[model samples]
Target: MRRAVATVLASTLLFAAAGCGGDDSGSATDGGPDKFKVGAIPIVDVAPLHLGIAKGFFSEQGMEIEVVNTTGGAAAVPGVVSGDFTFAFGNVTSLIVAKSQNLPLKAVAEGNSSTGQDGKDFGGVVVPKDSPITSAKDLAGKQVAVNNLKNIGDTTVRASVRKAGGDPAGVKFVEMPFPDMPAAIANHRVDAAWIVEPFFTTAKNQGAKVIASNFVDAAPDLTVAVYFTSEKVLKEKADLVKRFTAAIEKSLQYATDHPDEARAVLSKYTKIDAGVAEKMTLPAWPQKVNTASVQTIADQMQADGLIKDKFDVAQVLP
Candidate 1:
C-alpha cells in the first residue's frame, strides 16, 4: 500500500508542477478547452481537490480550472448558486438546509468521506489531561466549545452525549473558531471542545484527553462532504461537471494510495508542515456517490431541524 501510494503521489506531483505555467484565465484551456472556476473551503476534507489541480487532473480533462478558497460551508452555497463558482465543496448538512430554502444547487459529486482510520471524521470532545471530566456523561453542566453553533461540531457532540447515555442538552455549547478552541479550553472559557483537525491533533499533543469521538457515537458512513454545482452550471456545462468529477476522483485515488505524497502536495498549497500533515488522520475518498450514505446525512439533518421540509434522498444524491 505504501509503495503504491508513493508512486501515485510522485506521478501527481510531477503532473502538478508541469501544469503550473498553464493558462490562468477562466476563458482559455491549455488545449483550447472549456474554462471553469471551482471553489473549496480551506479544510483537510477538500485536500483531494487541491491534489487534483496540482496533479493536472483538470488539465488532463481539457479544462482550464481556477480554485477559490471560501470562508466556510455556509458561504460556499451562495457562491455556487449565484454562479460565482462552477462548483463548490460544501458540507452535506449545510447543503440540505440550502435545499430546504430552495437554493438552486445540485450535488454533483462526492468529495471526501470521514472515517475512524485516524480519528479524522468527527472531532474528539477533549478536556485538559488533568481535568476531572473524564467521560461524556461527566460533561453535564460543563461548557463546551465548537467551531460554530448548530454546525457539525455541536450536532455531533449532542449525538455523542446521547449515545453515551448522557443528556444531549445538559452541556452548554460555546461557539469559537478552531484556532481559538484550544486557548478557550486552556483558559477555562469552556470546559472542553469538540474540534476537528489539525486542532484534534494539536489538542491531543497538548495533553487533552478525548472523552469521545464523533464517529464512535454518531452514525458512521455519514456523507459529511460533497461537491455542489448550481442549476445554471449543471444545465449549460454538464460535460465540464463530468470532467471535473473524473479529475477529482483521480486525485482522490492518488491521495488514498499515497498519503505521504498527498501530504506533500497539501503542504505546498496549505503551508502546513509536512510532519503535521502526515500525522493527521485524513478522510477516505469514495469512488462514487452512494445514496445510502447521503440518506444518512439527510436523516440526521432532518432530526437536527436543519431541514424543514421532507427531501427525497434520491433527488439529492448524484
Candidate 2:
C-alpha cells in the first residue's frame, strides 16, 4: 500500500515541483513560520480549527493561520497544489482520490470523525417530512443532492443503502452546495440530501426526516476528514508541517474536551444559526489521526470506482 501511494506521490511531486518556479512562500521563513494559509470550508468539522485560533493554539507555536474558505475539498486541492494554501481540510476520499491522480497531497492531522451512532452522527441523508423515503432502502432509484458528487458524500450514502439491503448503485446523485440542499429537498428538486451538521440540524428543524447516518454506516468512528498539504510543502516546510500538526492535534483534543466552546466557535466562522449550531450533533475530533477509518474510506473509493490505483492511506499520514 505504501509503495502504491508513494509511487503516485513521486509522480505528482515531480510535476508540482516543476510548477513551483522558486516561490518560497510555502517555506521561505528563516524563523518559525509566522503566518500560513489553510483552505477550509466553514463547516462544523472545522470548528476545532476556529476554536484553536480563538484559543491561541496555533499562535502558541509561533505561527499564525489565515483560513481561506473554500466550497469543499474539490476547491481545497487546487488551492494547495497551486501554493495558494499551505494546508487544507478535506475528507479521506478526496485526499485518496487526489493521491490516485497524483495530486501530491498528504494528511497532517485528523479533521473530524463520526459519532458512530445511528441517528446521532453529525452527517446523514434526509428527506422532507412528507416524503415517502422512510429508510435507506427507500433511497433506491431516488435523486439525492450531495455537496459534491463522486466524493465522501456519495460513497458513504452508498454504504448506507447497501447496509439497508438496497442496491447502492441505483441511487442517482446530484451535486449541490450544503447550504442549498435543505431548500432543494423541501421543493422536491432533489428527493433527498446527504448533508452534515448545521444543515443536518437545519433540515431536521424544517421537518425533514433522517433516513440514515451515512458516515456511521460507512464505518464506526469514521475519520470523515483531515487537514492536508501538498508534498512540495511537506518536503520544503518540514518545520511548518510539524508545528502545524502538533497544533492541530492539540486543537482537536481541546475541542473534544470542550464541546460548548467548539459549538460557540462555529458562530465566528459560519453563518449557521446560533440555535442550530448549539444543538447540532458534533463530530469527534480525535487528537490522533484515525488511519483505520481512512483505509475504510479508501476501500470505499475503489469499490465505487472513484480511484483506479492501489492507494495507501499510510503514505498520506503525518
- By lDDT, the best candidate is 2
Who wins the TM-score comparison? Answer: 2
Q: Can you write out model 2's per-residue Cα lDDT over 1-318, one digit (the tens) per residue?
A: 353354455544644664752342344367765677889998899998988988998888878788989878866776677677778998887778777776778888889889888988888999988998888999889999988777899999999999999998889999899999888877888999999988889888888899998998998789888899888777877888888898998999999999999999998888889899878999988877777888888888888878876668888876
**Candidate 2 off by > 4 Å:** 1-33
Candidate 1 local lDDT, 83-114, one digit each (tens): 56677887776676666565667888887776
TM-score of each: 0.83, 0.91
RMSD of 1: 10.2
Model 2, residue 69: what's the lDDT?
A: 94
